[model samples]
Target: MDAITQNLDLFWNGFLRSLTICLWGGVGSLVLGTFIATCRVAPVAPLRTFGTAWVTVIRNCPLSVLLFMFAFGLPEIGINAEYYYFGLAALIIYTSAFVCEGLRAGINSVSAGQAEAARAIGLTFTQTLTQIVLPQAFRTSIPPVGSVIIAMFKNSAVVGAFGVGLDLYSVGESLTSAQGFAALPVLTGVAIGYLMITLPAGVGLGVLERKVAIAR
Candidate 1:
């Protein structure tokens, strides 16, 4: 217990840093993913192709390779990581592909008849999508989306390899080396941290879904 306590104190700043990385990365992915997914649904053929290609490339690549490329490749071009921007950039790109697929499934699940009905009521396709389709689609996608967000949060641990020194996974690794304990304690902390964020998000999304359903 004392060993764990000592390690906890040693790793506090790292945990806090990791929290920031995960929170921002997950939310950033959600916003950008939603936008790209919307573009894929656009009537324009080029946009659909572009969005599809974007998802394909990122989804097919492993996260570690993508992070390594972003960390090393950008600096060669002068976008240096003196600002920690590279880690965030990598995370956003890595997670966005997943979020895009999740949202695409959600949007597709929205019945075709609903969009047709919305259009019949004098709503433009854009209006119907924004006002009617999205809300319902989001509700339907909440479970899967929440899961993706949690995955993104866990993946944020990968940023430590790019020299984001203070994140949770980094801290855990540091502690394990410094304290010489088994991996159980460090992994336990990481698991708890993930559940702490994701469980509440899942519950809240569930509540929101029920509220929307009731309103309808």
Candidate 2:
């Protein structure tokens, strides 16, 4: 109990940092994801092929490896190390690929006639996609998108692997190193912190899916 009280600040800071990374990755990836998904499903075969390759390669590659490559490898190529952004960049690349597929699936769920109707109403392809297609697709895709959000949320811990300061997993390691006596309790606290981020979003996503289904 004393140990728990003593280390609350450390746990709080680390969890917040981890969460910040997740939030950035989640939102950043979605923007890029929508664009990539749209282009992948474009009539142009070359765009489709390139997008497909991007998604496939990122999905298959282990995230830790991606982190290693970006954090260490980029500097060797004259890109230099900016720790937070490197993690953020890798995360954006990784999660965008996934969110691309998720959004693509959601876009496909919308009927082609809806887009045709939007075009009939004087909306350009971009406007039709933004106003008509994506809005509804977002509702339908709540679960999948939520899953990706949570995944990015959890996987942000991987950023700690590259020695970024004060993220949750790294903090856990630091705590273990600092207080050899309280390692179990410290890690358990970290686990709970992660659940706090993950579980609520998951439940909210379930509610969203149900609401969308009922309205349909």
The numbered model that scores best in TM-score is 2
The local lDDT score (0 to 100) that residue 215 gets in candidate 1 is 40
User: What lDDT tens digits, residue by residue, belong to model 2 across residues 94-189?
Assistant: 999999999888878899898999999899988997899889888777778789989998888878767787988887888778667477787888
Clashing pairs in 2: none
Runs with alpha carbons beyond 4 Å of true place in candidate 2 = 113-131, 214-216
- For 74-186, candidate 1 gives per-residue lDDT tens digits of 88897775525777887898788888888888888888898899999999978997998888888777767777877777777777755677676766676677657678877
**Weakest lDDT window of 10 consecutive positions for candidate 2:** 207-216
Task: Give the true-structure RMSD of model 2.
Answer: 2.4
Q: Against the hidden true structure, what lDDT does model 1 obtain?
A: 0.77
